[model samples]
Target: MGGPSREMTVMRIPLKKAKHHFGASLSRGTRPYNEDAYQAGTIDIPAFAKRRPISLTRNPKGEIKNEVTPAGSSSGDPQVFYFGVFDGHGGNECSGFLMEELHKYIEDAAKDFELESSLQIKGPVHRYIGWSGSAEVDEQMPASGSAPETTAEESLGAVKTYTPSGTESMKPPKPGSKHDGPTPGAKSRQSPLSSAPPVKQSMSVRKAEDLERELVMDWKELVGGYFRRFKPEWFSMSAGGRGHPAEQDVIAKRHYPNSAVPNEAVEGIGIETVLQYAFLRADYDFVSAQVGKRDEDPVLADRAINDDDILGHPSRGGKSIGGTKRFKGGSTCSMALVSTPTPTPFWHPAAPSTVVTAHVGDTRIILCKTATGLAVPLTSNHHPSLPEEATRLRRYAATFVTDSFGEERVSGLANTRAFGDMQSKRIGVSAEAEIRRIEVTSAEYSFMTLVSDGVSGHLSDQEIVDIIKEAQTPEQAARDVTSFATEVSADADNATTLVVRLGGWERRTEGGLGSLGTKELRDWRKAEAENPRGRM
Candidate 1:
């Protein structure tokens, strides 16, 4: 905020018997508070010998059984590389929360694959989990009760409609119109603290709260059950069931139906679904905590409630007054997951890695091709101006307006999709992520870049790629890109950059801005020389 606040992180990831380098840099640029957050690391999945099991096997009696033993530790745990960047608005709390909890949820969601076996049969399962009909099954399942569940959006009628051309604002619903809320027999979205049964709406209508509850219950049952299976002492020692009273009650009263022995197999959902699940779960937890709902899980509790740096009510000058967490803040999230290639029948040893990109809001990821320094965009920004995003926001009759700076804003938010903007939830502001997958050959791509809007807004994709290619290391690449953003933008926002070096990093062909002696390149070099270590 004052002098630039800069932070750097470097990670060494093992990929196909080789060490890969990745790093991140964050710089507070002209902002009173730096709300951007990012993370990079690895997630270990149990390695199965031949095939990875998604669901538990069933016996003749149709009762679920855990066949794997606790001591059955397998070899070759597959590690997934994870990189995420979050940009916060209104406050830093939301981004900060994501920095700590998003990856944990992703790891938990990944476990849904080998839920039972993952616990007992430890080690990385070599196979990538392909799409199964689990989502279809969940979609087809009837709502928990006779009546359908209601979402907050339903309670508040559409007051406006946003379109690619412009926004059309509508008058408030007529005094006695259908905008009043859910009809009789319809269940309302409940707070995690509420004793009311969670609203089980259709997938199309399900809110973040619903998914958050499902995640918590699933963890309590699946993981807690794992501890319970071994020993009573171990369960207690593991603190398997510690949490809010309401959560504990829910856990005690119900269990994951999937945990029950099934007559047929239930395959785990694909990685795309896992990413979506994690994004929603993390968003829900953040929103719920803002309203004072806290979980006992150490990781969840630490970020949700214990961080003193978390922003409080905006009305209270954005600082926690009297040690109480307050008000709604929002964060945009972009993440990339790199998993080992699922082997083909022929078993090609040099298969490309599968890269999954999932995100909401304006942050994005770009892949730099080694052949010609090509910038390939993996994630698209979700702004109301986009046709698809505009159509989605229109369902809630959301309004779009141009700010004084000439940027389009949905309702009052810059992003149509984001995490933790609780106030805008009713108007169809969403945390639902856009998921994409690609196979990257180490010979074709040099690296991947993940950046918050601050950097992307100031630098073109090719320019970013060229800057990273010009750097000596991932850390320097991150710093150079972010520092360059500040140099170009008069009022640069908090800029954050992450660079992931791939196998082709050393074998790149010069092209685009990287090969040109452009004025931009000269200006960047001049700025770098003058302030080699300015702020960041």
Candidate 2:
């Protein structure tokens, strides 16, 4: 019996890949620290007005679930840009599904409107068919696909009654009478009545108008039902470990009518819906570029370039020292789509198009107004330090560790909010996404860096800003910042960086090697050098 039991136990052990508990890794606590630096070389170049552009990079720590979608339309009729970043936790199913379906839904809605409009202009054939006593029959057709046929009396009630005998006397003309017979050899006369002054057909005109109105109303109702049916498939939530239909209802209630929904819940549906409509109303275009060893390899670089070579060749960075891979995920995804229906009448030409970024466990949307040098942060970071996060942490009995950067726990994995890691959510560590709106002005345009916590974990925000200040181009700044982080946390896991710089405008070009004058710049540089790898 004991031998059989042992064999059964061995057989019952589950395979690692097949396990569903997303929390298994988290429950095991942090991985053993491995100190190795990954170094990639850097580029030295002068800043140019036209040379600046956005840059991105990513590295796999282990397994990651991040997806990004960027689209733009610049038809000159209405210019619009859209960008979205979805960071999935638990699994990639939700984010991946959303990336493909959201855009299609928007496009489908637009096409439905166009088709409805075209159907409104019914020509003469439509008028004749509609007038041939067919409308009454259609009205009695039991609402097309509805079940349960109507009774004969009910169907007949829908048709209008016309009694000829009561309305006008029917006088049968006598055989060979003058009214019925052709006059004997009288000059064949054309009836003056044939060209009688054109009688204005008000009834026909009114029918056409009614048809158009009905077509519009039907289209609206159909689209509304479609949205109601499909929106719930996008998300799922449970309460107290029990099945709750109300949760589905809550998400369904959030769907906007022909509008884009923001990540935030309090902002309500109207504002985001209207903003999305305006932004998507115009046409724009998008192109995604990557910078990393995998992308820059000779064979891979060839296919990444275009005829116009709008995206230059992939550039290499420092070497990867073994063990420096901070986050075990895929590369960061960044995209820029054009924003049409420009907010201003003056036409702000230098905006960053539309920027969307997603880290392995977070979602962020950023809009860059290059003309005004403003970086509007349309979403918030899912950090664990917020009040809501603190409450969640207490529920999980999770401890917090204070570092120079701020207060983080478990080497920052314990952030109150994150994208992936369903295991975390099981412990009440739910992610609360924040959406921020900041104006990016020229003064703030030095360069922008959007990175995963793998990099941010080790470096302070000011430290990153200083790196941008030191580098000549945005790409160089990204590399330098990444390099510094790797070096400092040579013992850390996967680290990644994405940098965006404003182009198409002129700025000061004087300080190359000696421009570390400002107090903010000096402080930032000092902080960066002191903690290059972000280790506290």
Using lDDT as the measure, the top candidate is 1
Model 2, runs deviating above 4 Å: 1-381, 392-413, 428-432, 438-446, 503-505, 508-536
Estimated TM-score per prediction?
0.58, 0.35
lDDT of 1 at 102: 83
Off by over 4 Å in 1: 1-20, 46-75, 113-268, 293-323, 342-351, 509-514, 517-536
- Candidate 2, residue 84: the lDDT equals 41
Global lDDT scores for all candidate models? 0.53, 0.29
Q: Which stretch of 10 consecutive residues in model 1 shows the poorest summed lDDT?
A: 183-192
Tens digit of per-residue lDDT, candidate 1, span 334-418 = 8877654221110112224556677788887887765555567777667776777777666546778999977688667878888
At residue 183, candidate 1 shows an lDDT of 14
lDDT of 1 at 129: 19
